[model samples]
Target: MSDFGLGVSGLAAMFALMILRMPVGMAMLAVGYFGIVIMNGDRSANALLVTEAFSATANYSLTVIPLFILMGNIASATGFSRRLYEAAFAWVGGLRGGLASASIVGCAAFSAVSGSSVATAVTIGKVALPEMKRFGYSDALATGSIAAGGTLGFLIPPSTGFVLYAILTEESIGQLFMAGILPGLLLTALFMITVTLVTLRNPEAGPRGAAVSWPERMRAVLRAAPLLAIILTSIGGIYFGVFTPVEAAGIGAGLIILMALVMGKLPWGVLTDAVLDTVRTTAMLYLIIIGASVLNPFLALTQVPATLGEGLTSLGLGPYGVLLAIVVIYLLLGMFMDGLAMLVVTIPIFFPIMTGLGFDPIWFGVVAVILIEMGMITPPVGLNVFVVKSVAKDVPMSTIFRGVLPFWFAMAACLLLIVVFPQIAVMIPQAMFR
Candidate 1:
């Protein structure tokens, strides 16, 4: 068979394995290994696999992932995440749908430390849902807000999505982090607007919360000061060039641990669980990276990415038209594929085409992350929606999905704004570098 045909078959096999409930890394690894054997020989494939596995695990920059994750896990365990919501609530809870708005605010704050979308959703949802319910907020609004807000985890600084994007594309991690900030804040604002519109139309849906006294608001903010300071210091440090991402993550995680210890919040058992969870998550990410490494080499041998890029460029569509087409394809695949899976599998094929078309890699990274995040709240297989359902058990999946639709459109709007004014994504990074 032709090399291109062989590549197509390998992809089909990988998808088949994934559909059969095999782990994503194993599926990619299995396809990559045998494809290499077919195209070359057993010895070549063995060497590739061994080298990739070792290099992926040994990479120093990846240490940031575990450290950021540990910081988030410790915050969740010690109730620091809860205080973020409390602080936001004291300030905004008096507004219509304010509790839900505070959830988005809390998610945005927590996302600075926690890069995982599911973790952000789960942590914020658990705290916000119960309180919103007590306030007689609509299920659609309450559940929808948390599910949508959780997506900020993927678009914000310290994002795992951007990290994987940087790794796959070999772009600067700091630039990608900078690119994400404006877009993240923009999306957060859009989400809050959606909540305001929903509550405004149905005034009964999100009632005005009792006004908090200025003294209580200050007190609440004070209570959340430590985590807030950590968020500012870590992200601000990266912006000011005071620390690299790995260094920032290490310092942030260490500070959180020390705070928990001093406050007597970290029990021996909780610390053990948090450490074990971090290891488990780090292992899974490493496996996925190794699988992508092996698969990329095999795909290169088959010339699939090059062929795909040629095909995309040959279509008479100008650059913007081609970009729209890529966006549509991402949306369709995102309906069924998990966000990270979509990133690792598709970037190898699409990244070259985009750069050839003259799109800024950093700007595209922000757009791509936002698009994938929208999928996390999109229907038929929305991961964050399911997380919301898990937290709000009595609420049907349908309600959560319905609630998420408005926020999904809000994300779409945010994506459009960033595209029309590409500088929004690039400005922060450019200023930082200059």
Candidate 2:
């Protein structure tokens, strides 16, 4: 078979394996290994696999993944996440749809630490779902808000999505992190507006809570100050060019540990559990990176990326027209595949086309992340929706899907704004890097 034929077959097999419930990394590894053996030889395939695995595990920027994850896991174990929610609630819990709005705010704050969407959804849903239920918030509104809000973890600073995009496209991690700031905040605001409109249309969906006293609100902020400080130091340091991503992640992790210990929140057992969780999450991400490293080379040997780029260019679709096509492809793939899978598999092909079309890599990273975030709340396999279902077991999955529909629209609006105003994604990054 021609190299292009081999590449096409490999893609088919990889997707089929993933659909059959094989782990994503393992499927990519299997396909890439065999494809290389077929196209080259067994020795070449083995050597490529070993070298790529080592490269992925040893990459300096990749170290940021584990440290940031450890920060989030420790924070979750030590009740810091609860304080974040409490602070958000103190400020906004009395407004109409206040609890739901508080949930979105809490998610944004937590996303500054945790980069995984599922973790953010699970953590916040556990806290906010029951409270909203007790306060007579409709199941749809309560569950929907948490599911939609959790997706912020993928867009905000320290996001794994941006990290992987950086690795795949050879872009700057610090710049991607900075670029995500405005778009992330934009989506968060749009989500809050969705909640407001929902409550406005059906007042019974989300009723107001008792007002919080100013002193009480101030106290709540004081309680959550440790995390706020950590966020500012790590992300702010990056923005000022005072620290690289690796340095910022390490500093953030150290401060969280020191603060937890000082506050007596780091019990021996809790620390152990947090470390184990971080290892599991980090290992999974590293495996995916390694798989991409191996698979990407095989795709290169077959000239798939170049061919796809030429095919895209040949369609007479101007830059924006091609951009729309790529967006649709990502949205469709996201319905069935995992977000990280979509990133590693597609970026190698789509990224070149985008940059060749004169699009800014940093801005495109923000736009791509937003599109994937929308899929996380899209129906059927929307990962966050299922997460909310697991938390609110009594609430039907269909209801959770229905609840996220508004927020999904909010995400689309955010995507539109970023498309029309690329500076929203690039301004901070440009100011910092220039």
Candidate 3:
């Protein structure tokens, strides 16, 4: 069979394994290794496997993964996430559909510290779900807001999605982080607008809570100040070139731990659990990275990316048209596959096409992350929807899915805006570098 055909078969096999309940990393790894052995030789495959595994695990830059994960896990343990929710609630809870809006705001804030969508959804959902339910918020709006807001974790600064993208694409992590900031905030605003429209259309869906006193609002803000400071210091430091991504992650993790300790919020057991969770998450990420490392070379050897890029370019679709097609493909894949799995599998094929079309890598990274975020809340496989479901157990899965539909369109609008005006994704990164 032709090399390109073999590559296609390898991908098919990987998906089949995934469907059979094999882990994503292992599925990719198994296919990649066997594909290499068939295409090259056993010696080459063995050497590649050993080298990629060791290098991916030992790389200093990868340390950022664990540190950032630790920061997020500790932030959750220390009740920082709850405080953020309270602070946002204090300001917005009086508005129509305000509790739901506050959940979005709080999720955005928590996302700064927690890079995982699941983490953001679970943590914020725990805090906001009960409050929204108590205040007579509809199940759909309440659950939808949390699920959609959780997606911000992937688009906001300190994002694991950006970190993984940077590692894969060889783009600067800091630049990607900066590029995400404006788009992230923009999407957050769009989500808030969606909530307002929803509440307006059906006043019974969301009843406003009593207005918080100015003094209470001030106190809530003050209480959440330290968490906000950590976000600004870590993410802000990266933008200002005051710290590298790794250094920022370390500092953020250390500060979070310190704050938790000082507040006596992080007991020994909680600290230990945080550390273990970080280790597990970091390991999982490394496995995926290593799998991608192996799969990339196999795909390269097969010349699939080059062939795909050339085929698309030859279609006379123009660059924008080709990009739109790619975006559509991602949206479809996202409905069935895990986001990171989709990224690791497809980027090798698409990144070259994007760059060859003269698109900026950093901007593309932001766009790609946003697409992945959409998948997190999109249909049957929407992981964030499930996470929200887990928290709002009383709510039906169908209800949660129904809730995210409007926000899903809001995301689509955000994506469209960024596509038409690429500056939304690149302007901050450019200024930061300049």
Candidate 4:
């Protein structure tokens, strides 16, 4: 077969393995190994795999992933999630659909500290689901809000997705973090708007609510102060060049551990669990990185993405047209693929195309993350949605899916706004760099 044909075959086999429920890293590794062997025999394949494994694993930039993951895991174990929820609830729980809105706000805050979408979903779900259910909120509303809100885990700073994007595209992680700020806030605004409208239209899902006492609200805010400090220090420091991304992550993780110790949240067992979780997650991500190393070069050899990009450029499509096309493709793929796997598989191909088309890599990274965030709440393969459903086992999957639709629309609208006015994503980063 032609080299191009070999690439195509490799892709088909990868997807088929995915369909059979194989792990994403294993699927990629398997396809990559066989594809190399088929095209150039056994010795060539082993040589490629050996080299890819060492180089990808030993990458210095990759160190940021585990540090960030350790930061998140420590934060999770330190009682910060509860504090975030309590703070948001105290301030916002007085509005209509207050608890639900609080859930989203809490999810956003939690996401600032935690990078995994499923972790955000499950962690916040444990805290907010019971409260919402007790307050007579519908299963759909409770499950949907948490699921959709959890997608912000990556859209916000200190995100694994952002880290990966930076490493892949060779953009400054600090600049990308700054670029995500407005877009992340826009998404939060959109989700809150969606929640308010839904509650107003159907009071059954969320009845009118009372306000909180100023004193209690202040106390809640105080409880959340440590987290706010960590977020600001990590993200703000990076933006201002006070520290590099890995250094910021280490600082954040250290602060979180200190807070946990002070608050009596980190007993010996809890500390052990936090460390173990971080190690496991970091190990899993490293495996995927190695697989991507083997796979990315093969995909590049196909030249399909470059050809398609050239075709689009040759068609005289404007930047907006190219951007729109990319979003549409992500939406279609989101239906079938896990976001991380999709990102790992597509980014090597798409990043070059995007840059070749004159889009800024940093801007495209945020935009790509927004699309991935949407996928986190999208159906069939929506990881966040599934997490919510798992937590709220009593809630029907259909109800959760239906409830998620409005938030999906809100995310889509946010994506459109970012595309129409690039400044929304670029302003903070540019200002910081300047």
Give TM-scores for every candidate, taking all chains together and pairing residue i with residue i: 0.98, 0.99, 0.99, 0.96
Q: Write the per-residue lDDT of candidate 3 for residues 396-428, one digit (tens) a residue.
A: 999999999999999999999999999999998
Top model by lDDT, which number? 2
- What do the candidate models score in CA lDDT, each in turn? 0.92, 0.93, 0.92, 0.84
Report the candidate with higher lDDT, 1 versus 2: 2
lDDT of 3 at 85: 93
TM-score of 1: 0.98
lDDT of candidate 4 over 211-290, digit per residue (tens) = 78999999999989988899889888888789987888888888888888887888899889988888888888888777
Q: In candidate 4, how many Å is residue 258 off?
A: 1.6
Estimate, for each residue in 1-434, the C-alpha lDDT of model 2 and write its tens digit.
89999999999999999999988888888889999999999999999999999988899999999999999998888999999999999999999999999999999999999887888999988999988988899999999999999999999989999999999888999999999899989999999999999999999999997799999999999999989999999999999989899999999999999999999989899999999999999989988998899999999999999999999889999999999999999899988888888888999989999999999999999988988898898877898998889889999998999999999989999999899989999999989978
The collision pairs in model 1 are none
Candidate 3 local Cα displacement, residue 247, angstroms: 0.4
- lDDT for model 3 comes to 0.92
Off by over 4 Å in 4: 314-316
Better of 2 and 4 by lDDT: 2
Clashing pairs in 3: none
Candidate 3 lowest-lDDT run of ten: 55-64
Q: Write the per-residue lDDT of candidate 1 for residues 104-189, one digit (tens) a residue.
A: 99999999989989899999999999999998999999999999999999999899999999999989888898899999999999
